[model samples]
Target: MTTPPFAPVTDADLAVLSEQLGRPVRGVVGVAARCVCGNPTVVATSPRLPDGSPFPTFYYLTHPAATAAMSVLEADHVMRELSDELASDEEVAAQYARAHEAYLRDRAGFGDVEEIAGISAGGMPTRVKCLHALAGHALAAGPGVNPIGDRALAMSTWSPERCACAQPGGAG
Candidate 1:
């Protein structure tokens, strides 16, 4: 048996996630990572929804600041630069491949989905498409797992080293 790489979700987590997303959170299996203040920074989700839909995103970034930073980077066209880096740099490309494997391993706990087999979100291994997905994988697996995610985090104004959360009832 393999140990899972995430923390279990709690009722408090569900509440905070609802606030972070401005909607109710669902299908979360675990708290993949946390803010320094213990907010749900990333969540591990089910591959198949209760409604029988296939959701490929296993590691989901939930913190508003992190998502906002990724949004800013995307608006700046960073994906193109990262994709070019993947094409030009062998070491980076290799690291991304490892990240893809890590993603698959992490997602395997939710069982398998045929439609998304061998497919991890954010264009892993050969491309850099979505910073949200890459950053989710990075935060969940920590810094060195995804090169693109690490780069994106470093490039962004938000830093995971701190707690930038506004918890429910102002506990933050």
Candidate 2:
């Protein structure tokens, strides 16, 4: 049987990647940044959900096709191929910064609200509850209040109350 390629990311590396992405480094996520041939790459430590659990951290080369693809096995292979190219901490940080900036720039034009709603619906109960809560909020806010409008604003502000899912440990 072929062994699967998998590796743990150091906390230091995760911090470096978080800095590059301009976000708080919450868990064990890291990116390879650049391959030996100077191609861009990305690595993410796939942490569990808000509830503690185990899952695979993913790593991948930054090819055009890999952007929309999510596969654990493929991510492992790409990480292995680029592992040899990892050199200095500074090099890795720089590469991560560049790749992250490119990613952010590329996502600048996407505006799919339905996609956001789908992601928010974690399961049947969550979906039903979220939709009901949204309906209540819409009703309370009145007919002129658009749920999508509220969602857009909540997204910009990161308000948990206005979010689709109930706040952790709070009422749905």
Candidate 3:
């Protein structure tokens, strides 16, 4: 099982994440992805929260702009289009399956939760339920790892290469 690369979390990172989420962040393991400006874009969360609840989503999207872009895409029914593509395209479907496996493997590195076992976020291995989850996984694992995620990122208005963070040093 290959472990997904994650940056060490810091107090400043938690501060930025709290600012982005508009609440105190919890169960965060590390910063999975960050904007070019050094602010976090995606965070790696524990499978089980401090409250002992089973959490399925390992890679969580935190960047407000990226989240908004994914929301717009979902509102425009991009999920249906992507689902259709998944159903019709065998190669893409296979790639998506591999992505689901990769997601599970990565999450297993953190810990195993029986509740979320064999379950990957974004309706992976079958459907495109949530672009936010897909995009978050793509950003965390990097390009070519999640084809659907890469596609969603391509279709979205947000770009990780660009700094859209409202916090310090993000404007450019």
Candidate 4:
């Protein structure tokens, strides 16, 4: 499997993550992808955290604008629509299943934490629980991998090709 490798997360990157998440980040292994503005879009986290938390979300989205856009979609009940589509579309379902498998391989690359083994974020393969997680995976893996993620990205106002990241203190 040719899963994408993570970029080295610098202290500055950590700072941006802290700001984006509004909390201190821990167990960040590497960066999965970045926004066009040179800010972290997806981060590859450890399966096991410092506090013994089994964090299954290996790919984390951190760009404020992208996150905000995902939130808008979720708030608009786009997940329910996507979930219905998953039930109705066999082709999309198969593609999503592949995405689930890909997620497992990438996390296993870190190390197997039995708790999260075979489990990927965003209710993948079965449902569309969270657009943020799907979007993060899409950004990390690139296009044509996660169908739901690609759909979400297409539906959202955010664009990977655009540098719409928010500056520190929520500036443009």
Q: Is candidate 1 or candidate 2 better by TM-score?
A: 1
Identify the superior model by lDDT, candidate 2 or candidate 4: 4
Range of the 10 consecutive residues with the lowest summed lDDT in candidate 3: 163-172
Residue 89 alpha-carbon offset, candidate 3, angstroms: 0.2
What C-alpha lDDT do the candidate models reach, one value each?
Answer: 0.88, 0.30, 0.92, 0.89
Give the per-residue lDDT digits (tens) of candidate 4, residues 5-72. Answer: 67888988899899889999999999899877678889999999999989999988888888899999
- Candidate structures ordered by lDDT, highest first: 3, 4, 1, 2
Order by TM-score, highest first: 3, 1, 4, 2
Q: RMSDs, each prediction?
A: 1.5, 22.2, 1.1, 1.9
Model 2 over residues 87-149: C-alpha lDDT tens digits?
A: 234454344344333322222222223322223210111111222222222222333332321
TM-score of each candidate? 0.94, 0.24, 0.96, 0.94
TM-score of 2: 0.24
For model 3, residues 140-161, the per-residue Cα lDDT tens digits are: 9999989999998999989998
Model 3 score (lDDT): 0.92
Instruction: Identify the runs in model 2 with alpha carbons over 4 angstroms from their true place.
Output: 1-3, 29-40, 50-172
Best by lDDT: 3
Q: Largest TM-score belongs to which candidate?
A: 3
Residue 12 error, candidate 2, Å: 2.9
Per-residue alpha-carbon lDDT of model 1 for 110-165, expressed as tens digits?
88899889999899878888999999988888878899999999999999887677
* Candidate 3 segments exceeding 4 Å error: none
